[model samples]
Target: MAPLEYLRPSDEGAAIALAEADGRACLLAGGTDVVGLLKDGVLAPSRLVDINALPIAGVEIRDGGLSIGALTRLSDVADHPAVRGRFPALAHAVLAAASPQLRNMATVGGSLLQRTRCGYFRDPVTPCNKRAPGTGCSAIDGEHRLHAILGGSDRCIAVHPSDPAVALLALDAVVRTRGSRKERAIPVDDLYLLPGSTPERETLLEHGELIVAVELPATSFAARSCYLKVRERASFEFALVSAAVALDVRGGVIRTARVALGGVAPRPWRARAAEAVLRGSRMTEATIAAAASAAVRDARPREQNAFKVELVRRVLTRVLATAGAGG
Candidate 1:
């Protein structure tokens, strides 16, 4: 570990300015991910700007939609009545994350901004393009059983590790942020960046930009949604393949559908092709099978992670069925 200064800002602007002034300063919200990185020597910031005192830690109903403060705990969001009743997928995704203790300390913003669990990236001694650009990606030809199959390039192939992010992508959530320049709203789909050549830049967030809240628009499909995660164990483990599905079914046909996959891509992947196959289609085994096949049509699985191609298809089929049944 490295010696660092800690400062708590009285306001959002002050926090952003403090971070912007020092290029190596890092914002600390829940300290779940940032602390771990610091201890592991993955990050050595000159200063830690504590933003826990900021007035941004609650769930609110905003004009028929939902707004979750960035500092809000994952456990609180999971247990919120509005989240459970309206955005079931979001609630389930939070519950399906880390254990109860971690959920209590992990904030919504921290979860979205959490780094990948790729062993190469976490170990400073290893060669990982994400951790140090220009260095080779060890996972490419090494142990990549948990690497990405979709949206991967020769530069890197590490899967993202956030269950709630997948649900947020499916719900079309927008992340609200306040930066050194101005406040802006970014779509959840646009928040992540692929590891094309700059694997070091994981997200689209600008330097010194702080996530304030997440806005989820009220949609008919949001209520009838489901999240399914397949992991090696029942607790304290990351997903091998996961799917979040939202369907608005009228009469017997699907009206609107939202499909997102995790643990098989560098980011929370939106299966637009699968959604296109489901719209106006009857909720049946045949329809789900076709949609599932379409979801993995473009998958470029590696040697060790090739099983993920079939695993994601099965998971998507089950999640879509679950969401459709709820409707």
Candidate 2:
């Protein structure tokens, strides 16, 4: 582990100031992800800025939508009555993450900022474009059982490793950001950048910008929402293929549909084309299959991850059926 100087600030201003002053300062929300990286020597920050006291934790029902604070723990989100009732799909996604202990410590902001789970990115000995700008991506032609199929560039093919991200994408969430000079809101889908030439840059946030909260816009589709995660093991494992779906059925016809996929993309893959196919149509196995088929039409899976395409179809179909049944 690298020698790191730690600082615990009294408020948000101090935290932000410290981050602005030190270019290499790493924010420790829960230390679940950052600590592990530091221990493994993949991330060697000179200073660690503890922002736990910056008042970024809470869950509020606002006039527009649900405003979940960045520091709000995953367990708190999963257990909140408002979240469980209003956004059950988001709750389910939280429930499907790590374990009780980790969830109790993991924060919403940290999860959104979590790095890829690719082995190459974590091990200093391996080559990963995400960790090093000019270094080659080891997963490109190596053991890639869990590489991305969507939003992957030749520079990198690592998958985003968060289940909550899929549900947030389907819910049309927006991220609120605060920096030294200004504040702004960025749509969740727009937050992550594709692995283009700058594969090392994951998010669109500028330097010294802190994620304040995430807004989930109101939608009637929330009434019929579900998140289905299929992993190698039943519990405490990352998804092999996961789907988040929400639909509005009117007079036995699909009025509106919201769909997104995880465990198969560098960013959450929104199934807009599939959603378009389901709109104003009657729910039938053939129609559902067609929509599901459209969702993975552009999937570009590498060698070992080809099986994920079929699993994605099956999982999404099940999610749609459940949402259609209003279960």
**Best candidate, TM-score:** 1
Q: Which one wins on lDDT?
A: 1
TM-score quality measure for candidate 1:
0.99
For model 2, how does the per-residue alpha-carbon lDDT over 16-80 read when each residue is reduced to its tens digit? 88888989988889889998999889899989998898887999998746999999999999998
Residue range with the least summed lDDT across 10 consecutive positions in model 2:
10-19
Task: Give lDDT tens digits, candidate 1, residues 32-83.
Answer: 8899999999999999999998999999999898999999999999999999
Badly placed stretches (over 4 Å) of model 2 are none
